[model samples]
Target: MTRVIVAAGGGGDAVAAVMVGAALYGAGEPAVILTYAWDRLLVDPVPGPRGPGDFTGLRPLTPHVLAVPAAAEPVAPAGSTLPRLAAELPHTFALIDPHHGARGIARQVGELVDQLAPESVDLLDVGGDILARGDEPTLKSPLGDALTLAACCRVDAPVRLLVAGPGLDGEIPADVLRDRLGAPVATLAPEHVEALGAVLDWHPSEATAMLAATARGVRGLCEVRGAGLAVPLTDEGPTVHEAGLEEALERNELARAVLDTTGLAEAERHSREICGFSEIDGERRRAARLGARAPAGLDPDAALARLDRFQADARARGITHTTFRRIAEVLGLNGTLRLDLRDLLLARRPEQYEAPLWRVPAEV
Candidate 1:
């Protein structure tokens, strides 16, 4: 029977999903890993869902079914998290194009389901925010998870929704998640922690926070500041919990509202209707404006000057930290090059620059 594992949150979730899959299905179980090209602006310079045109070459597995070639390199310079997964996992990794929105994406997923005829499909979310009712004050980037969840509901395969490291993403608090989750069937032990740690550096933030909290032996009411401010966390044994996909949709008001969305724009509109505001969308607009005016080639001296002004503006707006990725986006630096520049700027942090947002105030 064919089985598939999909990351509810892109980027690091893809890495975390594999860890969960291995634990449940045994190592090297030959499951297709499905993720998206999008990532948080904090993690990638080019934020937001990328279009099919952005990909250099995508082999069509079936009609309306596009899969990333084993060695496909992104057409754009924005560092994509998908390629990393593709490189590490080789032929097993595929990316979903969310540009088509909820209904379009669900159709693609249906095509995949039809081809594989999978006996079961598991949608794995690193954080428990997928369970949020959309009114949570801390909720940001709910569109991706909501869109994926809506699409999952359309699949004929029996689907299982599992959330790991509850509240680690700093969106939904652990206590909140616990109140909703009856109990977890599996807990993240030291071995699982070790396996996760091996690849934790690849995708930082939430994944790193969970690993650190587990290592410190901190549980219940822990705090993580990666996503924003001092977000609460719960040790709760770093467990992975399972829930019926249908029941999960029923509980999430926003998910249910957008389940029938035909496109990305419609999904986004419904998201704003339910959640009130979208920080990810706002940042995307700013990044797009920045990219539009950005020079084709970067001048470090000029770029740093712009960043200095940006820091001042952020401070004026009471923004604590600004990620190097955001700076790269504003400066219009391309993929690997932006990462390279970040390393150099980080090496010169404190002495040359100062910002509360820099993870390491004193060191890179």
Candidate 2:
């Protein structure tokens, strides 16, 4: 079903509106209609040529279009007397306001919706400046009540109140929101603006909620995948390859495996060069022989320590290591460091170890 997102107050309101629009578009929905209300004083006057005989200075304009809508063909405002502009941009839409009070503005928006009856509509009400006085209620308590009532009466589709910034004050409390709205009430994060560029690619429509949920879910998964590859360190260092380090290294085929997955030909060549300099194969063979002779006394912890020392030596020889924390988290590592060593073996470059194992694209 198509849903209407109503953004009430602050900079966060704008962010929420943009996100909601992007989510809908990502779901392959039609363009959304965005309407913002501000105090009359903040509204700029439309400039015109002044006549020599005119006595009054430039008259204050009631409402002005701050931004054109982002749509193929924007619907003109009801009872518009101005000339219609041609649609030249993909995200084009209209900016409109009522010359009267807040109630009058709401009525006008309601009338517009009634006229259009779009499959879905979203009303983003960025709260007016509190310093200014007008017939429209302040965004805190009264405005919230008015909007709730308006949505209940006017819009037949799902209506959501996206409250952010200071406007959230005196409105519904967090605990009460679920009982009151009978739907989800989400908070807007201040950092959302950083992702605006990625977000604009999305188009708003009926399935906006689903798109948002999916994006959030995928990000969570990626984080889980990245966290699984971290090797734990103890006071004595690594605890896995002390006694049979050489044999374990040969059996695991770490070098060959890393070269295969990373897809970095240059890095693979570098690793091979480093391996030759360190004589890793010969060292592993000697360790394996020693391990075989002392098999009865071999300690797993000591073996791990030896592996740690080997890794340190490799690092000292200018060998780079790539850690993939984010990809591990996304892979759902349950605090376990049991990584599939094959991934590292196949990686051609150290950086390839950090790359995501799964091919999920990042969306804001």
Candidate 3:
């Protein structure tokens, strides 16, 4: 029988869940992965989370919850990697609609359990941001994870919250999470990273990329996001920390604030009131500025020259590594060009590049 693994965050968490599932259960175990189709603002310009109406050809699992088939595609102006993931990865990907808030999510989970009858359920978060106190300066997105936490509390099955690659999301620092985590349950090996295969070639999740890199013995300070948070990577980067769902909820103030919320706005309002931050507001503002335009093409020589300068500056700043997203931003390329930039940079300096991140070569 299949196990239920909830992708606590979004795309990256979904990928991490596959790794966790394979480690916990044997490889190729059939699983029903409940996930949100919320791609980053760069990928999907749409301001908040997309509901059932946002996509076409979703297989209805229930009145509220929907299943995204491999053929499913997001409606116009809305883009998602879930369908592509459904096709590439070996798991049934179900869509989580947080439009109706936590209660609705609880109802959806209950319905799913009744239908699928999975052996066990796991709530996976790539980073420990799911345990954010709502006041951390680095906290970016907690609404979705909070919604999952609150809703899982109401689900009939026992849900275990597994945090893989803690603080890799660049939100919570690894040192801060050290005290919060208990004994490590598992460590991702190169084989696990290899299992992900070609998805690493184009997927834009920096944290997940770091996880794979860590498994492959990568270590250094990774500068990520527009904020340029310097995340320290160590050998512990691949270790998975298992924490109680109750304890995690206890640590997260935002999750408690949105437990009774019925609408997405209600939850967002709670977030603003409790955490003093609105992720949707940030997304809306960025969407207005960035629009949906694709990244502009650049001359090969000029691009490499610019990258050479960017690398020198980063090295001077003690930044040993960075993600494609950061490189795209540095080159003034829109988010759409992240993969193209990766391919270009890799083709030029294959030895200095990892799958989804680049390592700055020592001054030579």
Top model by lDDT, which number? 3
Error of 3 at 232 (Å): 1.2
Candidate 2: list runs displaced more than 4 Å: 1-6, 10-14, 24-28, 37-93, 96-98, 123-172, 185-195, 198-364
Model 1, stretches more than 4 Å misplaced? 42-44, 193-198, 208-228, 231-234, 288-364
Better of 2 and 3 by TM-score: 3
Count of clashing residue pairs in every prediction: 5, 51, 0
Q: Rank the candidates by lDDT, best first.
A: 3, 1, 2
Candidate 3 lDDT, 1-364, residue by residue in tens:
9899898888888888877777778667888889988887767878887888888989987777788989998998898888888889888889888988899888888888888787988888987898778899878888899999999987888888888998898888878888888889999878777667688888878889898888788899998877577887888899998877888889899898888878999999999998887788988888877765654886778889998998888888898888888888888786557767777878888998765578988882
Candidate 2, residues 1-364, lDDT tens digits: the string is 2333333321223334554454333323334333332211111111111111121111221232233322222122111111111132223223333222233334434554555465655544322111111122221222222222232233344333332221122222223322222222333222322234433222111112122222333111211111122211111110000111122123222222332222223323333443332222333454455445522332334433543453454345433332232322222221122233223323423332222122222210
Task: Please tell me which model should have the higher lDDT, number 1 or number 3.
Answer: 3
- Give each model's whole-structure lDDT: 0.65, 0.28, 0.84
TM-score of 3: 0.96
Q: Per-candidate TM vs. native?
A: 0.74, 0.30, 0.96
